[model samples]
Target: MTSDLDTLFSDAFERANNTTKKFAPDVQLRLYAYYKQATKGDNFSYNNEDNLKNAFKFNAWIQLKGMDENEAKENYIKLVNSILK
Candidate 1:
């Protein structure tokens, strides 16, 4: 079941990322954060001041810090659906 879900989430994630239709900034951040959380979990980190973009991404990812991968994946899919409507 988990594997199936992972596969499903992967497809959804790809769709979200690869869509030529542009998303609003807020929606994009949600997608970015959810994607990072789903894929990287606790291993995702950005501790350096190398780039402001990275800092924003780090903050966004941290906002969803407590979410597990499956939950994040679910949210990712939901977010995509909402934006599509």
Candidate 2:
């Protein structure tokens, strides 16, 4: 059975995905980082592409290295709720 945090995280992901409002770059990066950290944990890998956007994403996610998945999920849920406010 899925944990409560996992269910809440999935609901938050759905809300974030369905939102129509555009967010600032920093907010977007935070959402991206939190989502990645929650889902992929610390085992994520990215290609060394010269794309600045990819680099930024990698940096944001890397900063959350060693964060627990449940913690990341909680953070992501909080952010999504704040944004939807």
Candidate 3:
């Protein structure tokens, strides 16, 4: 990845920090929680009380599907790099 990844992650992080102002409070919370779950590991299971019972998994699918695959991969790598630092 290039320096652009750092920039992209920084920009996304800032928007995420202000998610409440940029989106509905519930949407912000959902995004925040789902994002944490999505990037936490290589394994993702949507078979849960909140996701299955509440049908939030569909929204989760949508959120992830909208991401640019390559960019998201770079962001994930960049995020892990920052953590290691």
Candidate 4:
């Protein structure tokens, strides 16, 4: 059985994904980072693509290194709620 947090996280993710509003780059980065941290934890690896956008994304995600998955999910949900407001 999935935990309540996991269910809530999935709901928040669905809400975020279905939203049509445009967000600022920084906000987008935060969302991306939180989602990645929540899902992937510290097991991160990326190809050396040399793409600036990917580099920025990697940096954003790596900055959340060592964050607990549950905490990341909570942060992601909060951020999405704030954005939807």
Instruction: Provide the overall lDDT of each model, using Cα atoms, as 2-decimal numbers.
Output: 0.83, 0.94, 0.49, 0.94
lDDT accuracy of residue 26 in candidate 4:
99
Candidate 1 total steric clashes:
0
**C-alpha TM-score for every candidate:** 0.84, 0.95, 0.36, 0.95
Candidate 3: regions farther than 4 A off = 19-22, 25-42, 51-54, 62-69, 73-85
User: What is the C-alpha lDDT profile of model 1 across 1-85, one tens digit per residue?
Assistant: 5687788788787787688899887788889999889888867667795688777778888999879988998999888877765
Q: Give the Å shift of residue 33 in candidate 2.
A: 0.5
**If both were scored by lDDT, which would come out higher, candidate 1 or candidate 3?**
1
Tell me the deviation in Å of residue 27 in model 2.
0.6
lDDT of 3: 0.49
Q: Which 10 residues in a row give candidate 2 its minimum summed lDDT?
A: 43-52
Q: Taking the tens digit of each residue's C-alpha lDDT, what string does model 4 give over 31-55?
A: 9999999999998988897699999
lDDT of 3 by residue, 45-74 (tens): 454466443455445434565455445546
Q: What clash count does candidate 3 reach?
A: 0
lDDT of 1 at 75: 91
TM-score of candidate 1 versus the correct structure, residues matched by position: 0.84
